[model samples]
Structures are given as structure tokens and as C-alpha cells.
Target: MEIDYSHIKVIGFDADDTLWVNETYFREAEEEVGKLLSHYETPNKIDQELYKMELKNLGTYGYGVKGFVLSMIELAVELSNGKVSNSIISDILNIGKRMLNKPIELLEGVEEVLKTLSKDYRLILATKGDLLDQERKLEKSGLIDYFHHIEVLSEKQEYNYSRLLKHLDIKPSEFLMVGNSLKSDILPLINIGSEAIHVPFHTTWQHEKVSENETNGVDYKTVYSLLEILKFFKNN
Candidate 1:
């Protein structure tokens, strides 16, 4: 089946793994936390428990490094029966700091793609994460000028995208979303009658994964690299 880009006037980009390195840092932090809490449980068990903790606390802390750090600390206490050392807790805090401070490493051709597309289409950033952290990353990315609008969403769902389109005065058919996660970036837009292109990262957070059945009949394009998306745009 062929998907058309003729009607797409606004191109929405997902900030994290789609444009630059993001999930990679979380994976590294998870490994570090796993090692730090190894005394309480095995590495695998620690990883599993920590994910559960994050899911459990998602509502309370929303998303980003701070919430992840809190989940790690809470899990450490739980796994250790509240006897986890303060030094270990401090180590987890430092891990979050390192992740938050890490330099932005843009994926290949990100700037070129954004620059080329922005010329012919309105480019907006619609990503979900901590507002402060997302803003910090955008400023550091040096790609801020390419985007006409930047939105840090609490969640990426059909309703969220619908509301965004409404607020921007964009029709569903005029918006196109590009991102790595199938769950957050692809499915929601498709569900809302907008277009989406998937550019899968090497590593995906467990929560952002979708089952095969969920994508079985979905109509969306998947490109191996961000640059490949240029082929679908007439201006490029």
C-alpha cells in the first residue's frame, strides 16, 4: 500500500531517539542502577523490578530522568527491605545527573533532514518528557531554529494528538509525525487519522513497545534511517 505525503503541511518530530541519543542513556543508567542494587537482587531481577517501579510511579512523576531516579531509589528501598544504604541512593541520584547533563548527539542527517523539510513544510517538535529537560535538550541541540513550535507532551495518545492538531489549527490529514517508538509516535497519530513514519532506534524502552497485533493492520511507513524519509517528500 502506498501512503501519500502530498497533503502533509506540518511535520512533527519526536525529540528523543528519533532526532538524537536518548533511550541509550536510560539503558546505561538502568545498567548502573542494576549494579548498584545487586546486593539486594540479581541484575535481571533488579531490572525487572525497576521497570515495574517506574510504571507504578509514572502518574506521580510523569516522565524523564528525575522520575526514573526516584523509581530507582524507591525500588532500592523496597528490594532491600528499606535497608538500602544512603551512599547507594546517592549513586542513583548521580546517575540521573549524568544522564541529564550528557551532551546531545544528533542522529545521522538529522539537521539536514530538518533543514530540508522545514523549507517546504511547517516543522514542529512534539515530544513527551520533563518540560525543563526537553527544553534544555532542544536548546543544546542547535536544531531549535528549524522548528516553528515545540511541545512537550505528558503522554502521546490519540486524544493528545487530536488536541494538539486542534490547538495548532491543523487538520488531522495535514499533520505527519516522525519518531522511533511505535506506541507513542506511530500508533497514536495513526489512530487520530494523521500520518506517521517510524524510524526505529537500536534500543527501545519496554513501555514504548507495541505488540504485533497492535500494528497488524495499521497504515504507516517505517524507514530504516531518518534520512530515508526525504525520499517521500517532493521538495527533497
Candidate 2:
């Protein structure tokens, strides 16, 4: 397939699954949550309730393991009619703590790609999550030096990208974003006249999943892996 980077000056990368293992841990934690709450309801029902809790609390608490753990605590109370034990609550908290301590496992070619791109274009780590958590991961990844800036957004929307570009003093047409979520990474940039590439992760948060109808005529390209991007550049 053909592509263009002729006018691209600044490139943005998404963290979590795009750069390393992320959604996989969330999946594991959810299963553990199910087991912990199994006495009150079936695992499937537990999952459904948890998803609803997450949605209801998204605006209140935003994203990250802290919000997730709190949601789980609230769900436990509701499902058990406030009879859930302290031990169970402690287990849920521990789950979040363990997730916080997870090692940064970079995806294949992450360093090589960043190192190569930094030489020719300004790169930014633009991902959405809790500020403190994201910083820890970026520091741990040891890829911090390659980025010219780091933006940990509360949300990824058209307006958000527009404001970010304005802050960076870059034009939409000159910015290119690459990441795993179509909802968060690709469509919004395209909507704002910036370019995007969809590098899909094997696991996506349900909240970040988008429908075909939402993407019908929008222009973007999808690559299977992160490093495949180097081929699009002139001097790679």
C-alpha cells in the first residue's frame, strides 16, 4: 500500500499496548475480580456489573488502576448488599497495587523505531491515563530520551488533539499520530486534519473499541505491528 510522510514533522505514539503489554494485565485483573466476587453472582454477571460501574464512574474518576479498584470496591458492596468482607476488599486493592508494579515490557522494535524516528522527526509520547502512572511507565521504558514532549491526556478527542497541537505550535497537516486504538488514536486526528496510523494491539479496552460506521469514509492506514512504520520514511 502507498503512504505519505512528506509533510509530517511531529509524530505521536500511544503508550500501554501500543508500546508495551497493558490490556493483557487488565484482563487478568478482571478475571480475578470475578473470582473474588463469585459468591455473590456468576462470573459473567460480575463482569457486566463491573463494566457498568466503570462507565458510570469514568467521568468521576477518569482512567487508571485507581479508578478501576474503586469501581471494584463499589461493585462488591452493591452486589453483596454491603456484606462483602474486608478481606475481599483488601484482595481487590492488592490487585491494583500489583498492576501498578508491573514491569514495562516493550513491544518488538519499539526502541529501534523510536531511535530511528527521533533522528528525522520530533516524537511525542501522547497517551491517556493517570499522570503519575504514565510517567512511571515512560521512565521505566527507558525510551524517554527519544521524545520531545509527553502528553498524558484525560481523553482523546478532536478538541483535545486540536488544543495539543496548538500548544505545541504545530499545524494539523504536519502532525502524524500512530497508536493502537481507532477510537482514541486514529479517527480524532483524522477529524482534525492531522494524519494517523492504526497499529492494533491484540487486546483493546471495551471503551476504546470503535464501530465500522464511525470509520466509514475517514482516511487512515492500519499496520499489523509498530515497527512496520519505518518503511514509510525516506531514510530508514
Tens digits of per-residue lDDT for model 1, 187-220: 9999888899999999999998889999999999
TM-score of 1: 0.98
Clashes of each: 0, 0
The segments of candidate 1 whose C-alpha lies over 4 angstroms from its true place after superposition are 1-3
On residues 1-236, what C-alpha lDDT tens digit does candidate 2 reach at each position? 57868889999999989999999999999999999999999999999999999999999999998999999999999999999999999999999999999999999999999999999999998998889999999999999999999999999999999999999999999999999999999999999999999999988889999998999999998899788999899553
Model 1: worst 10 consecutive residues (lDDT sum): 1-10
- Name the best candidate (by TM-score): 2
**Each model's C-alpha lDDT?**
0.93, 0.93
Error of 2 at 97 (Å): 0.4
